[model samples]
Target: MQNYTLLPEWAKQEAVILAWPHAGTDWAENLVNAQHTYVALINAVNRANAVVLLLCPQDEIDAATAALASNNQVLIVPSEYNDTWVRDYGFLTVSDNHKNYPISFTFNGWGQKFDATKDNQVNSSLAKLCQQPLIENSIVLEGGALEIDENQHLLSTASCLYNPKRNAYMTGDEYHTLFIECLGAKKVTIFNHGHLEGDDTDGHIDTLVRFTPLKGIVLQGADNRPHDPHFAELFKLQYEVSQALPTHKIYSLPLPLVLDDEGTRLPASYANYLIVNQHIIMPIYGQSEDKNALVIIQSAHPNYTIVPVLCHSLVQQNGSLHCVTMQVPTNTIKPEIIAKAQLGVSIL
Candidate 1:
């Protein structure tokens, strides 16, 4: 009878976990730009008075350390990983009786679109380093695919969680039951519509919708161009969210239409921002709408400081800031690791 409640992203955090980008992964074509984005993201999170646990491949540790100027708020550990998108493979922390427990779910590389054997094993290595026992589950889920509000209301997309490629064996009803039993979700709201073009996760809710600190929902609106393919679906999504959370205020962020060199639409989303401590690290794609998106998010979270990080390079890979990092809730890590993180000591 463990009363485990899924912690929201805005919960007081012990550390922000990130796996560094390297030449081994898809970022090899633009590794420098990707690393630069990571550096900017790390610096932004560090300034928020939150500890950072950075996992880097052994060969990239020196470069990453130098790039970050050896920031004391960061604890760099040498590790092996298939990719840098740790948000999907990292821990989804829960709390019970005021104590935090990190849950490690099975990540199948976003429905096996990518190689994830090593990515799936990252938490096992991290648990040993943090000296924190992981509450392991074989369920297929990703941190980026779900968002929890302060009231234990969980927001997710049916396209990702219910896709046959990801969980063909489980019905939507089964997932609803699992959410209640494991995450203590009082309400599970699944968005039937909403997706970003070029998104590889089928449809991660983080890329389209997010829960704001003001008890509101800030979701990505379709491109203003009516001819855009995402326009209609996003409109319906907005309506669905409004209906689902009638009591909560709804704020819509303009989705900037950004394309890669190949003319492929990159999933540039304002809703993919990360909330750490009292700061919100928002991803901006250097589009004209970037300023407006910032203003809208600020209105949604007036009490917090909004730190904008340029994510042009990140979106080129079809993801953004929140897709690359995972927050470690307070008390989730062992005291020793927290101590070392505070002292800016590399665990390895």
Candidate 2:
């Protein structure tokens, strides 16, 4: 396989794909809320781009169709999935300006901890739907573990991608070689992130730091309390690493005070906002810092509409907007071709 990296937002996309949640897994108890959230996401993203939704084989697509019936910016394709975390299992797209393909690396439910056999086929099916080549890498790779800059710089955490359980067959250097041959990442940009009590992915970059087009990166900060230890360690680690980056800029967003209900800490962070074509969608917990986070994100993305989705139930699942939604690059096919494809689907 040739080395490849993700195309920038400005790159052309064929369409955005999302896997709907099922009661079997990923949304066992929260299937209803996840469905509503999925609808809202479809509504929002369809404003600026075409959306292709993946549905379970035996599942009813009427709910999605009813919610989006008034809106003509979507297409629902029947597909099967074990979970709704498509960002990790969905295809990772790459292009070289002339040709484009969807990369389908092996997904082992983030190291076989979760049932993922069905989730693995998303890449091939998505590629077949798009009529593009499906690039398959035997190694286990999750989209959540990577953050890239336009300048070829990458950011990742050892706790998530480098976990021994995730890739016991490969060493660190061996993994780097795979990155070079598989994903055109120049080099792995590493940072030391401390563990948080409620964090399940062990420091996913989307929850810890995010790169902004204008203001650089807005990161989650824990500079005050020392009792949890992660407060001091994660805060310092984020600051030091940001200062070290020569080309990219950085800004710190205040981390929300951890929410706990009945002695359980919940994963909460303002960094989990999603970037659509014209809007930056975020989850709101009605906290005082919500305003602050919005202001910061708005200032960073001046051209985008700052959309806040009510995420009370979403946080209970330990992820926010970015964690749930994946952006498929638009303009992948030529404009004339896309226009023809659009004509095939009814305008209703």
Candidate 3:
């Protein structure tokens, strides 16, 4: 169990981590397009903070280095990985009263669906890179499956964490106890209702609800339609859960009509937007609804500079802006501490 202190959205972050796309797994049919979009995302992130792009092999590192014209903005680390969803496998950082530490919740490839050997390695690698305490939790958790507020309360879904496929061994309360221990979260409230039919991780809550400062949630809402089985249950869940959690506000953002090509509906939703220090990187579908989604997100986050990232390629691969990258806070500790802390120390 790792005790986590939830950092605010406006916290000063150090850098963002991205796993360079592999051809077979994430890119398969659209390798070139994914790479281009990844580069663009790296470029956008570099404007505000440093970026670490995990290269699969030495050859890939060379190629990525060549592709990224501004090498200084990005660091190509040789790390093998199966998918580009680094947000799930990457380290989750928390700053204690004295020093900053990153907690690596053992990633089992979203419950062992894919190869996560390299993804797990990323945890210690990132810890080594940041020179901070890294607590490895025994329980299975993904960064994508959890959201926290300044008060250390967590927002999550029963669909993913409580799903039998992910953790059939543990009961709901048992799983939540691990969350409390790892995140130091006051409570782990379950969003029990909605299910995104297209979501693969049994409906990740990041695609349904997001916290905006001390205000409330910017949630995805859809009308009940006979053609869509998930709508009714989803709406009921949102309303009931919002009522249960009154302290936290909930704002419904309309869902963009499902995007499909060749009869296959992709995981396209506006709720998967990423929040950086100075900017809110949102996904756009290039549809008329894209404008409305942007306007809604902008209204919710008036303080941030909203950056619309064309995520058609990313969505096709079943992820978006927030899924592709993970942020690491900058360390300004003394040089002597950096050298001493690298060996090891009990963060608690």
Candidate 4:
């Protein structure tokens, strides 16, 4: 048996990968505001001494460099991408006997909802840049679609993993076997309940649930209003998680009810927070529940500092903070790769 294991997010990270927003992406409408959020996110990750592996298009290299102000712990790599949602396309790091292996899974633009030809090729460039031989897999898995605990329990939603658009040939048993073979998951829990309005990924687990370092699971709580559309579904989701992970302590984070300019509900979820080293970079909408959510998250992760960044603009695109970044586990990135990235070399 291969001694492989998918590292949890709380694991020490060598860097966090972020794709810079530009006129080419959906952020073209609000590029300035989105760039501001990216700048803040990069700086926040840097505070924990985690390097930021920033990917920018060749045309935006100078602009991205200027936006970052000081590139102290930031490494910029020029590349082409279809979108800024790196969490779905970036490499997923697995470990065996302390050795890091970066796996590249196929990304089909969220069930072919959008064009992802360029996004699918990102890991090839990243593999050469990081100097790590990529473990290529044909599984249609997204980083944000699954969460793993320290015990190797994999948590995800059935809506995504079982969707016919992504993987039509695989049965549940086949997927289970592949999870064990590729991701080293000791157990897999697929929740049928849980979803957010305006979510484009078809119920990605990151928008609904998460595994924390304290052996706790944080779920996105629905609004208190009984008539709210998500109340019943989220309530069932909480029950499902409790029954599934009976030993874990559960914490509820309030869901912020945010709407776009057209009065469309946006998926503003606190469950989409990113864990980087000793920090939990949380997404906060300018809502009344922001403070309460922070308190709850801090209590669950008492050792880590909670860094909140305004994600009002991010959710407008149907994702939040965690959707835009992917963490590179420690020992995976080489020093030479960092040096080359800092010089803003074109990886593509």
Where model 3 places Cα greater than 4 Å from the true spot, the runs are 1-3, 223-229, 258-260, 332-348
- Compute each candidate's TM-score over C-alphas: 0.97, 0.87, 0.88, 0.96
Candidate 4 overall lDDT versus native: 0.87
Regions more than 4 Å wrong, model 1? 130-132, 345-347
Q: Taking the tens digit of each residue's C-alpha lDDT, what string does model 1 give over 78-104? A: 789888889999988888888777888
lDDT of each: 0.87, 0.66, 0.70, 0.87
Looking at model 4, report the run of 10 residues with the lowest lDDT sum: 339-348
- How far out, in Å, is residue 286 in model 4? 0.4
Worst 10 residues of 3 by lDDT: 339-348
lDDT of 3 by residue, 1-348 (tens): 334575654567656778777555668788887888877787677665544445455557666666665444555566667677988888777766646777777778776677778777766655656656677776677887887777776878877887665677988788677767656777778777776766666778778888888567888776523356556866886786678678767767666555657767676778888777778888887866788888888888888888888888888867778888787666622334333323222110
| Residue 38 lDDT in candidate 4 | 91
Evaluated at residue 272, the lDDT of candidate 1 is 91
Among the numbered candidates, top TM-score falls to 1
Off by over 4 Å in 4: 339-348
Residue 52's lDDT in candidate 4: 82
lDDT of 2 by residue, 93-164 (tens): 676544566787777876677788988876665565554577788778787777776655567777887777
lDDT of prediction 1: 0.87
